[model samples]
Target: MECFFKDPCFSHEEEYRVVFFQHDIDHNEAKYNQKVLFREKSGIITPYIEVRPLTSSKKLPIQSITIGPKNNVDNAQVGLEFLLIKQGYDSISVERSRIPLRY
Candidate 1:
């Protein structure tokens, strides 16, 4: 389980993580492996894993996306909406963070 975590020292890589743990089964050899895949980007070798949703739909169960507080958040929201639409994500609800941005 701890292998899914990242150290703060790697923060400079501009990497973000999306984690999903199977709650029903302890492990699924058919679905996943301990193998970590690597790819070179911007002269940095990044480690990542391929995660497939264990559902008949075979799609990531992403229901919504909440953009965090920041300046020009509306522009960001619009861009995200356009991206979702382009990607054929019809049902996802795009929302803005209610937390007011304080400069």
Candidate 2:
């Protein structure tokens, strides 16, 4: 999914990164590793991850989130399918290119 900076004036797309989570961790949990480094450089860093829609011909972000499972299939795709099922979808078809991460 796409992520935009919380700052309204920060419109430079290069600063954004697309992250995929392996588990059900929230925004804070995901960035725990980078907390110390960021805090040292920038005082009281309050970074957040905002989920964005996936679109065709979209420019990819430099960074991505990953969890340990070591699966060949993309965990992001698997997460989407699972979410669909939980939301009462009988069957979900994930296109190789445009799988929606959220409803």
Candidate 3:
């Protein structure tokens, strides 16, 4: 995906870096002291990977909610209806709110 940022002065070109996940290595292996390199778009390369333990020292719960498509009024109404039905509010109707907009 392409991303753009607005600059008030637009004085100089901006620089961006991309990072990707590499393979995991074992610490007790023969080549445990090896280093990995990452290449940039400008041909400049640098070491990126560092071998470490495969354990999380902290415990935390992650929560997430999935939402449906929201392209137009009808699509948004359908998504809202699904959410309402899941929440035990199936009596709600989107057709009741289909009145014409003033502007």
Residue-pair clash count for candidate 2 = 0
TM-score of 2: 0.24
Identify the candidate with maximal TM-score.
1
Query: Per-residue alpha-carbon lDDT of model 1 for 47-91, expressed as tens digits?
Result: 677877788986767878878778889899999999888877878
lDDT of each: 0.72, 0.44, 0.46
Off by over 4 Å in 1: 1-58
Question: Which numbered prediction scores highest in lDDT against the true structure?
Answer: 1
Candidate 1 CA-lDDT value: 0.72
TM-scores of all predicted structures: 0.47, 0.24, 0.25
RMSD of 2: 15.4
Per-residue lDDT tens digits for candidate 3, residues 3-63, read 3443433223232344543444544433533556465744876657744534483322212
Regions of model 3 farther than 4 Å from truth: 1-71, 96-103
Instruction: Point out the higher-scoring one by TM-score: 1 or 2.
Output: 1
Worst 10-residue lDDT window, candidate 3: 59-68
**lDDT ranking, best first:** 1, 3, 2
Query: Backbone clashes per model, in order?
Result: 0, 0, 0
Q: Give the poorly placed runs of model 2, Cα more than 4 Å off.
A: 1-73, 98-103
